[model samples]
Target: MESETIQEPLDRFLVSVERKAFVMARMATRDTDEALDIVQDAMQALVEKYAGRPEAEWPPVFYRILNNRIRDWHRRQKIRNLWRGWLKPWSESNDRNDDPLEQIQDPGVVDPGEGMDRKASMARLEVALANLPLRQREAFLLRAWNGLDVASTAVAMGCSVGSVKTHYSRAIHTLRQFLEEYRP
Candidate 1:
């Protein structure tokens, strides 16, 4: 009874973030259904494992759970691909036209007073971000998109400050390179 009282706020917090968490997971997985499953898994894992932790700690803890699930999914996909590759070595050839940039089309609908040039810039930035390495992508999103500070990012990623710094620096450099090449 006391535990449920303590966990009610955490439950509310998770509910508030559920939609955005699904969006983030979808972007990470590029699969809507898989993303939904990941979000559900993350929420369940949080409730079961960390429900008693202080409220101040839930954000990073929630993200850590979500991140681990995503990584596990990616790993399983990798193994599946490896087996599929052995069965069909021509699978890579079938995907020759699936350029990442082509998939990043902006809908071209903008709010009043928003400039086309700025929209173009944002679309280009999204492409660059999509091309980032997985760890770098996660670090950038957790820090910039989610607005978590370095310490929180470190907690979420299960890494030291230095590794986060390295990943972030590399992400910035790679994004700059992509922007220069595409000039969008």
Candidate 2:
């Protein structure tokens, strides 16, 4: 009974962040299935390893687990691709339907013009973010999108505060340059 009380907040927190975390993972990996797997693994790791920790510590710890899982996935992919490179004749082409990140047009907006324009701008920003270097993207998303402070983001990224600042600053500058014409 007491354990449930302790777990309730953690459960709520996980629910709150799950979708954003999956989107972040998807954006980083560009592979929907792998991103889903990574998020699941991160959540499991957080539950198993850090569930007993204070709630205040949960966000950074969970994000750190997520970032580490993403790195591990990328590392495994690099090795697999290397082996595939040596045995290229058996390679199969990917089907287009497997992508889960495709943006769907919404039908429920009250103001179609405003909603369409907003969606278009958001799509462009998403593309620009996906094109950013990994560290820069991570910094920007953690600080701006996920709303983590510099110290917390540093903890999550396993980097120093100065590095977070530098990465975040560079990311903002790059986005401004890339999306200069996206202003409403």
Task: State each model's CA lDDT, in order.
Answer: 0.83, 0.85
TM match of model 1 to true structure: 0.88
Q: What tens-digit string does per-residue lDDT give for candidate 1 at 32-61?
A: 999999999999998888888888888888
Minimal lDDT window, size 10, model 2: 98-107
The per-prediction tally of clashing pairs is 0, 0
Q: For all the candidates, what are their Cα RMSDs to the real structure?
A: 2.3, 4.2
RMSD of 2: 4.2
lDDT (Cα) of model 2: 0.85
After superposition, the stretches of candidate 1 with alpha carbons farther than 4 Å from their true spots are 109-114
